[model samples]
Structures are given as structure tokens and as C-alpha cells.
Target: MDVVTRCVHRESSVEEIMIYTGKSKSYVKSAISAAILLGMIEQLNGDIYKISDDCYGILNTTPSEELKTSLFKSRIEKWEPFILYLKYLISGESSVVAIRKLCSLYSFNRTPVQIENLLKNWAKSTGILDATGEIVDINLSYDENEILYKLNEETVNDTNVSLFMINILGENIFSWLYHDEIAELKKAILIFRDHPRDAIQCSGRAFEDVLRRISIQSGVDTRKLNGITQVANNLYSQLDSTDNPFIHSKLKNIASAIGDIRNMAGHGKEAKSMERWELSSTSAIAHLLLTLSTIKGIYSYVNENRYDF
Candidate 1:
């Protein structure tokens, strides 16, 4: 069925199958027989066959071909708790303590022992644990508790960077971005620590995208602005001219530093650019700018409510 769907759309001839599938006539005949046996194809006439509706829908779905095939294979193998536990794993929430807490919160009428058993089943099925419910030979490291898998160096770095972002940008910043912007931000954070250069470029682009939107909202004709830097400068100029000169100077310095580092890293002008310090500092400044420019109320709220909180 897969072979047929690879080349055949609505209908295909046996001769065409031989050509496209790069198979002999006998091989094609055997594959057709296997498809028919599996109820994936129905014989319409002498040589013409139609793929089953279920099979066709599976093959032509939203997910990628590889994912679709894996899902289909797993359907035959039949994994229990199909997706819920898998989502929990992918959320990077693997600590036994966290799991127990979640079970307590959500798993109604199920004892902790039963929840642990389910986790073991899921872990074993996913190859993270062996048949004996022990950690497998996957690259994951572990702590003394033997519950949560400790992230390796690259993953740890990425997590730290993303944590910093969460602290500065606030966890709910996604509420302000469009769907595509949220996707871009997620991709940036996913690779930032491991691949700072690419992440910096992505961050710079996001900064510009967000700044443009904010500029538009501020009643500024952003279409007249030359670029993001100009827009930023104009907004900064508007921020309380009677305010303390020292604060304005510091803000200018941070903005300049962020823009310089972003440009150097993004354009690939210098080798070994955007070292750890530069990346972290620029990220901090950019986050501040993003908050102040786009979600200014958040900054105001944090400052005014800091002691209250």
C-alpha cells in the first residue's frame, strides 16, 4: 500500500507501478496481493484497484510522512495511554516529585502506586526504561533520586537560556504575539544556548517584528521609519524627556550594546562572535526593550507592584 501510494494518486496502472516502484511485474503483483490481504486496497476491475478509504486518509494527513508511518506502525503495536504520558515527557517535567504532584492533582480515584505503574509502562514502551523499569542506555543522565533524567550539557545550557527568557519576558508574553511569532520565538529558545549565533539572529528578527507592531500601535507612522533601530530610537526619545538623564543614558547604552551585538552575530561579519557573555547580556537588554516597547504595561506593573508582591 505504501509503495502504491508513493507513486499512485487516484489510480495507477500495473505497468506504471512497475516503472515508478522500480519493481518487477511479479513483485508488483505480490505487493498488490499483500495490500488486498491487509484490506488496504480493494479490487475494482481486472487490473485496477482502489486504496481503502482509511488507508488513504492515513497516508494523506496533516503530519509528516515519517510521523504518519510511525503512528500507523504504533497502531498495530498498540501502546496504552497513547499521547497523554508522551506529552508529559516532552514537557521536560520528569521529576518523580513533580509526577507525583501532578498525579495527585489530576489522576482522580487512582492511587500513587497505580500512577507509578502507568508511568513505568509508558517509560518502558518509550524505550526510556527497560523491561525491568530501569533506565535504558539512552544518552540521558540521572541524579541521585533516580527519578528525573538530568539534562546533558547542551540541553542544560538551552534550559538556562530559556529560563532567563522566561524571567525577563514573563511566561505569558505569548499572549501578545501572533501565532507565527510565537512559533519563531519557540524555535529561537529551543536552539539558543546550543547555537547562539542562529538564536541571536532569530532573536533580532523577533525584536524587529515586535518593535514594528508596537510602533504601529503607538500612533507612529512606522512605514516612514527606515528600520527597527530607528523605530527604537524614536520610542526611546519619547520616554519622558524630563526624566533623569542618567537613566536615559543607561537605557541608550544597553540598547546600543544589544543592537551592535545582534548585528555582528546575525550578519556573520566576525568569527567567534556572540560569546556566552555577549549573548546573555544582549538577551537581557533585548528582553527589557521588548517589554518596554511592546508590553509597556507589564514593565509598569512589575515596578509599581514589586514591593506588594
Candidate 2:
């Protein structure tokens, strides 16, 4: 914290930080590196460093403990290794076991002992783990827990999916989406755990809404679009001839799947035995996430090259 505070006040080199903190050269260097890792500071030139722009609030006035903790938590939440560690803890793994898994999965270029100490220190400091290295009752929000569960289950096969989902939820990746579209997606994510069916419905609606917007922008006659599939296909057909046929075909399939899932949620098998058509909560949540991911990818491509579409 002292190193960060020093950097916040002025850009400092390693020697300057050592002089300001009255610490040994090695200790100052290590502190600066840790500060950079935690996103409290950023390297400027070769050796000089300053507080990160997002952390400038700590420049002059003393921040409250709540603000400090919020900053710490937000920064660490973006750290992949720390996120993996938290996922293991959420899945009932012991700290030792989680540390071992993390070590095996990622090469941190540090000794196991060093990695263990670093994780424990960050975990304890952020109140995520206690002194005993056990998870605390922090009452994680539904979406946060859902993300952790997905990361724990799916990262082994496709690590990028977990990270992409995390960024979608945590960052401003949806700026391309209109206000109402963004609101619907947020609604889906918010109720995905308790109201899985409704969540999937919301996700489907949001995705369909995007398709309709794109179709209209591309001069397609949306009046003839009967459902998401038609809307999606019409839009895809309008894509430039240079677009890859394989990608176009795959996107159409994904959009069609979203419509099919929405229909399953929208209509039950029979009024007498509605449960027959009801999807499991797990399946519904998975479908909702998949729909969101699909929307994210397609929307991003269209947004970047709107004129082409």
C-alpha cells in the first residue's frame, strides 16, 4: 500500500521508491512489481511508474476502507489466476488442493511455495479467504457464482469461453447493443439461477431483438421475418460475398438453436403434463449463457463492420 501511495503521488523509479519508502532495493522492486500486478500502478518508461488511471482516487485524499476493499476486489476479480483459485474454493476444494490444481494448470514461473503465499496473501487481503485459508461467507451474487461454476466445469476443455463470459459480465463488452437489448440481456443474467426458464426466454428475446435490428439496418424486409431464424437467415444472406461461407452457416445454426430453445421455454409439451417439456435448471442456464455468447460474437462482428453487413 505504501508503494502504491508513493506512486500515486508521483511517478517513481525503483531507486526513488526505495528512497521514499526507506526500504531495501530488493523489497522496493518486489513491491513495485506486486503493485503493477494488482493494477494499482503501471510502468511508464523503462523503470519509472505511476498510479494507474483507474486508481487515481487514492492520489490526495485518504480513501475509506470500503473504497479500498472495492478497489482491491475489482482489480483482483480481473486476474485470471485469482479467479481460478476462487472457483476451486467455491467448488468445495481445500486451499491446498486448489493451490495444487492452480499450479498444475498454470505456470507462474515461481516456486510452488511462492505461488501459494501470493494467492493466500491476496485471498486474505480481499476477505475472500480467512487466516486458515478457508473461503469466507461473502455471499457471492448469483451471476458471480454461476460464472465460477462454469469456469470450474468448462475451463478444462475451453478456457477461452470462461474468460470471455467473465469479460462480458464484468466489462463494457455490450456497448454495441442498444439500451433495450442490453437491459434484456442483463435481466436474463440476473434471474438465470432462480428463474431459469424466464432467463432463457429473456436471452432469446434479446438475441431476436438484435437480429431484427440488424435486418432492418441492412434493408431486409423484417415484415416477412416470422421468427428469429428467418430474421437471422435474412441478415446472413445480406452479408458481403467475401464473408466466409462456413462462418455464415455456423451463425445461422446458432441463431436457429436460440429460437428452438426459446420455443421450448415458451411452450410446454401438454397442459396436463407441463413438466415433460420443462428443461432442467442447469440446462436452461447453460442455454441462456450460450445464447448470450452467440449474440456477443455476432453483434461484435456486425458492429465492427456495419457497412459490410
Candidate 3:
């Protein structure tokens, strides 16, 4: 039967084999049984059987030929997470400087230019299009310049910040900050944070929530989210790394620590000033401010390096 299957599928059958090789009937029966167990053929209604769809190639290909196949099973690999990080950078919840840091951490098949192009395509698809498309640009009395500058940095705080001005500032921060912390904690915070009363911590709280949700959705089979909890921890370590070429580790630690505090504030965690320089959170905020100041210098350095590139 095995010889018969090969003969019919590749031009050879059982009776033909018996005539050609003079095989005994019992030998033919044993061969057929072996072929059936191999799944090269599927039994149909009663005795009639057909070759399996997979068997067509199996019958033709050399063993080595089967090993060569495309590995790109899906698009939800590291690339998707890279795009998310880019959005975080653009939205001011994270920094563009993060790109270099992440590149250093992960080996990728894509170059920075390729990554940028990929992001350009994804941004267009997701309505992140051009930066200009982002704002309503209502031409309101508020200063767009100030808003952009404030967004260029999320740590900005001053007495002069107006109630409405703070509102807009908070929105940008919240939009990107949703992926900042562990998701459940972030979600619990959001249940309380979305209130009109919860403005300051909205950015960080929302950021953590977004990341957690993404991590959860990318199930084990999805590839990218398989080890995402560790990925988040790595991202946190880098963002909080003192040797980050942008800020000291102490400041990074403060940034991450205050991130939780900000969540507490957003979730109605009581009398939380959420303010940086309040004597209690002072030195931490100054170093944070110092980190921001260092970021500005790094921004300049990054651009200069980009141009040279």
C-alpha cells in the first residue's frame, strides 16, 4: 500500500506493485496499515481514502527542504511594542532619548531609520499622523507655545500655571502616562482618577493602565507579550537607571517612586500634594527637575548627533 500510494500520487499503485515486485497480499496489508498511521492518507466514508493536504508536499520534498520556511508568524512581535514606545515619546510621557536606550537593550533587525518609517506608517494608520493633526488648535486664548513647551516636559510645575492651563497640561501627560505602571494598579487608580478632582496624577496613572492592558491582551500565543512583565521591568529599570546618560539613578528612582505617588493622588489617595517642591518631596523634585534640565541638554545633544548622523 505504501508503494501503491507513492505510485498513484507520484505514479505507482498496489496491484501494480504486486505485479512488479510480486509482493504477497499480507505484505501489502502491512504496508497499507503503516501508511494509514503516517497520516499521508485520510480515510473517507468507508474504505475510500484520500491524501492529506499536507502530504502533497511531504511526498515531494526532501527532508532538508521542509526546514527552510519564513519565521514571521505575525506582526505582534517586538516591533509593536517599539511603536508604542515611540508614541509615549511623542506624547511627552516618555522621551525620544528612550529610543537609543531601548536599542541598546534589544537587538533588532530594523535600523533607526527603518523603525522611524515603520512608525510613520503606523502613526498614519492609528490617527497619530502628523503632530499637527493632534491638536484641535481652536485658536483659544491659551498659549499653544506654552502648552507645547510644557508637554516637551511632563515634570513642569509652577505657581503661575492657571487652572485651565493645568487641565490641558494634565491631558497630554495622562494620554501617554497610561502605560507607566503595572496595569491593575493603574486601573484601580483610573476608577478614581478620571474625576474632575483628579488632574495632576492622571497622566502617570493612565500611562500605567495602558501598558498593563497591552501586556494582558498579548496572550502567550501572541509572541511579544509572552514575557512582557519582564519587559516592563526592563523598561522601568532603564527609565529609572541612574547611568541612563540622561539622569542619575537616584533621580530615575525618584521619577518611578513619584509615579506611584502620582497614581495615589489621582485615585483620591488624600492630601497628596502631587507637587514636587513641598519640602517633603523637595529634594526628590529638584533632582527630578535636575533630571529635566539634563534632559533639555540631552535633547540638544541628541539633535546635534542626529544631524551629524
The prediction achieving the highest TM-score against the true structure is 2
What TM-score would each prediction reach against the true structure?
Answer: 0.39, 0.52, 0.23
The digit string of per-residue lDDT tens for model 1 on 1-309 reads: 354474237666677667767899988987776466445667776787776776776665244666545434333222222223333343455646435645543533456666666556545654655786455524332221221122224433222333333334443443345434544554555554456566666656666676667555544456777544665676565533244221133344444554565676656435566343445533633443443343334232323322111
Worst 10 residues of 2 by lDDT: 154-163
Q: Residue by residue across 92-208, what tens digits does model 3's lDDT show? A: 543335455445545556686655554444444333345542322122122434433343243321211221222332322223322223232222222321231243243344333
TM-score of 2: 0.52
Model 3's TM-score against the true structure: 0.23
Count of steric clashes across candidates, in order: 0, 0, 17
Q: Where does model 3 exceed 4 Å of error? A: 1-98, 105-107, 131-181, 193-309
* Alpha-carbon local distance difference test for all models: 0.49, 0.68, 0.36
Off by over 4 Å in 1: 1-168, 239-253, 268-309
Against the hidden true structure, what lDDT does model 1 obtain? 0.49
Cα displacement (angstroms), candidate 1, residue 25, comes to 43
Q: What C-alpha lDDT, on a 0 to 100 scale, does residue 122 get in candidate 3? A: 40
The worst-scoring run of ten residues by lDDT in candidate 3 lies at 68-77
